[model samples]
Target: MEINELTEPERRVWEAFPRGAAVDLTGAPEREIRARVLRSLLLTAPTEDGEIAGLRLLGARVTGELDLQYGLIPCAVTLWDCDFERTPRLYGAEFRQLNLSKSRLPALWAATLRVDGVLRLTDCRIPGPVALAGARIAGALFMDRAVLGTESDGSQEWRDRAGRALQLDHATIGDDLWGPHLTVFGKARLDGATVTGVVQLDSARFHHPSDTALDAETLAVGTDLHAMRMRVEGRLNLRGATIPGQLNLAFARLANPGGVALRASGCTAGEFWMREAAPVEGALNLRRARFDLLHIAPEVWPGEVRTDGLTYTALAPVLPAADRLALPLRDPDGYVPYAYEQLTASYRRIGDDAAARTVQLAKQRRHRTTLPLYGRLWGHLQDVTVGYGFRPMRAAGWLLGLLLLGALVYGLHHPRPLKADEAPAFNALAYSLDLLLPIVDFGQERAYTPAGAYQWLSYLLIAAGWILATTFVAGVNRAVNRP
Candidate 1:
């Protein structure tokens, strides 16, 4: 429709749009664009060149509350370079398209808003928080190169009140949410979000030290979530999040020393790419985390990685026994049995039973080393007796030692035979054998009773036999029950 054919309010909003063959709104007046006028134009705007001729209120200072709660806005809205006296209230509103680029707003409360097209806020200055909780954007939400919160003036008040710079809790985006090079002062809340496309936060800077800087707990991203080179001053909470694609965090710097730097408990990802990244200073909790592939060296695995329940299908370059055990052995809170169990299972999954056994043995040895003096002594005894229930050959070695000692004693003593009817072919080896094997009595003990040192030797042989028999049974049971 022509400008003259429009209603008076519609004409005013249309006049705010730059009038030229080449439409550019770089010099519009700071006219007060009320919510009613914008709403009217959105509901009844004419089409131009197959596009909903959007009301471009460029350089205008929009006033009043734009309360479109539950209202479906029909036309595209572009308010470029505009200054808002108050942030628009578009809670639960549905928009065809929205572009508030280069605009200055106090805050944005667009929770549960539905955008069919792009929600562009590039280079915009938002002094306060931007709440997008439960929002559903069919297209991308672009906030590239934007300034999320105001710069700190060394004021403790502003620092203390910085709760969330951008809230995206439970939001579902059909396409990507690009926010590269953005600066956020507080947490970027993305808990429970389902992004069908990538959530790229490359080179973003977050400054919320000692607390969560980016909380993406339980988020499910259909594709890769790239946060490469992003700098987080506080913790990056990804607990229980699932990424069907790779999670790229190469060169990212996370600093929350001695606290939780990254909590990724119960996370499942297709591939994890953190090769050559800056080390996280604090604890990196990875309990129950499952990944198909890991793109990290055993040496480069963070010193504070808590891997009590971590499992991976394969390592990019499979490491040796020493390297594979390094990360789990660095658990500051002491030895976690499940951590070794997880490594053993991962190795077993890849058909590396030797590596799995190595992990199990390392676990036992470490446990023994950390025990009390008497406990360590008992553990050594168990090792010699049953090979900690893994080495049955050690039991045979003990049995052989006892047999030799008994035969030497019998040969030296030359004990007299108790039975006169027994045959004269007396063999020392046969006598030792009869004493050692308690189940089979070959009349050797009944036939002769040793004297002096020979008597003590027989007692020693009988006790050693009983010990070895019980330990052998236990070792076999352990081997059978193991998975």
Candidate 2:
């Protein structure tokens, strides 16, 4: 289109843009460039040496829908220090690059927008929702130091409410999603989003108390999800998500009292880091989650941590076996079988049989605390007799004690012989052995019987022998079949 043929607004934008480099339109009159005029100038700009330069609008007040539903932007579009009267509705817009850093917009409805280069919205103040559902970015999505959501009114209700703040659902980013030190007063939804690189929210603050502050459900991050030192007032959901790299929650403070503060159910990560994290006020749901290694400390582990179906291959090398079991044993819910299983399996994976046995024995003892009176008594009996299937030698020790007691009693009694052929000193030790071992008789038990209390000793020996022998056999069987 010729310069004379262009409309007034189009001519202004066309004449204002310098060829081959970035132009400063800050000194120009504050004109509200309509969408059609802006589109016309961007599509058919002046040629310079047989090449058209990209349009960079700086410090311009843009109005109307900057919609590009039917065409592709041939060059980059940069906006800086611009104020939009309405939400930039660029639904299905395709461009080489987009940078709206330091701009003020009510909202962004860029659903399915395709950007070949970087989409930088860094340091912008967006008080309304920033939706990018189904958009594809070939480069990084940088929103670092951005201030989102309304200002706090000091009302608890207002602080707790999580109005829609940021949405990236189903959006695909070729590079990282780096937003450090960013403050969001409401929820930041990344549900079903895919990032080829890390999703770093280090030192960020999310202040939504009544609802979820960060929801990244089913998100697939190729690298780590680093949220170290982040302070979240509500739950952070990553249920069914998969992170090929670590999910580092170290030094993070996530608080949602009486509700789940973090839910990573069915999520799989390469490694999990929770070392030195602040005490979570609510439950940490890790049900069915899997990780190769877990880096956590007992002091920072919350009071209520669900471990059902949660499995880890190894514990951090710095963590001792005792410290690992200490957390689950301190759970107020008492013995959680899966909690024990998680520890045992982790130790077993590292071929540490001794540690696995220790965890199993601790699990049995903890379980006994929650049982009825009779059940507890049975557990104690098993403990003294067989050491809960971990120590079969204890049963052998009891058997030896009983055998010696029977021998001393029989010798002191000096029973008279029933058979005339048997002598008075006819091997009293043999007689004791006969009574102590129920399976064998040696003809001494029936040949002579002790009178009074000595007779009671024979029956006691017989019952003790049966109980000890049965317990020893059962314990050995359990130890053999446990692995």
Candidate 3:
């Protein structure tokens, strides 16, 4: 189009494109600029060969849809603080860079879009879905403070389907994907996405109650995935995700009652930090997940947690074994042995043998509940006598108590001698020791036989000695054989 035939706003934009200059029309009367006019200017070259060419327009209302599907724009396109009449269609399109920051758009249909540089959508209010599925960006994708999707439109079909507000499935970003302070009303799906840099979602709010709020299953992040202070009304599913760096969710508030609040099964991360986070209303599913270091506060632990097969190299804050034992105790799956084993292994790895023993003892106590009546009775005997071998001092205490009781009883009465010539002495302590020691015999127990109640006391002493010996031996055997 000729400059002479162009509208005043179009002519000014055309004049500024050749020099890559920004035309700021903030607070000016809204002038309608056709999308085709902007496209034509982007396709045109500058009159001078040495001059740079790019389109930078600010605060203008685009009349028609900026349909650049399958088109290759060589120059950067930046339209800040502008209004789009319709959703911009950039499906299968390639651009040097695209910045639509602070723009008001109904939606963005940019599936399969490729950008050599950053794609900025900061602070934009998009009431509809932003589809970036299969997109490949060489630089960072920034959507800080952007608000995507409106409140439910009262459409049951959409709610049932769990309509996505922002879709980045299979989208690959060379640098970070930053969306701090972002708000989405529906599911924000990033399944199969790969980010070379951090995926920061600090203070973001996602509301998709009774369904998944953020589904990033199979996501591969080269660095950290920081979602500190984030608030989610539904589940945040990160199953099968791989993060080489930390997965920090400090101070996050997640609520999905009767369902999983955070489902990270099979996830692998260098560090997982949830310190000082608010109490989760639902269960936390970390089954089969592995982390180098897990830093979580016990006060924030929910009642129901599924941690079977979960492993972590170490735990933070260096809590005592008794305090940290609550983690495995909170497992909703009814005494998951693997959960206790993993916790024990974690403490062992940190060189806390005492803590490891505490976890193992707790494991035995928990496992007792799942046993039959007979097994449970045996377990109770072992537990009281030797603390399942974890507390060996209990055995010594029981031995001392039994020995003192037997001596006192036998000292009160004298037993009749089997033969007057065979009896050496009537020593109560000696006779008690003889009855208690089954493997070794003292001459006093055989030389004199107790009669009536005194005889019953000898039998009681013999039975008590055998029970204590058996229980101590069994507890020792169990401790030695444990893996």
Models 1 onward score TM values of 0.77, 0.85, 0.90
Error of 2 at 460 (Å): 3.5
Q: Judging by lDDT against the true structure, name the best candidate.
A: 3
lDDT for each residue of candidate 2 in 160-249, tens digit (9 for 90 to 100): 444678888899999999899888888888899999999999998887776798889999998899989999888889999999899998
Q: Order the candidates by TM-score, highest first — what do you get?
A: 3, 2, 1
lDDT against true structure, model 1: 0.78
Q: Between 1 and 2, whose TM-score is larger?
A: 2
Best by TM-score: 3
Q: Write the per-residue lDDT of candidate 3 for residues 369-480, one digit (tens) a residue.
A: 9999999999998888777777766775786787888788777877888998868988888788788767657788888898887788789878767766666666666556
The residue pairs found clashing in candidate 3 are none
Model 3: how far residue 290 lies from native, Å: 1.0
Superposed on all Cα atoms, the candidates' RMSDs to the truth, in angstroms, are 5.0, 3.8, 3.0
Q: What TM-score would candidate 2 get against the native? A: 0.85
Clashing pairs in 2: none
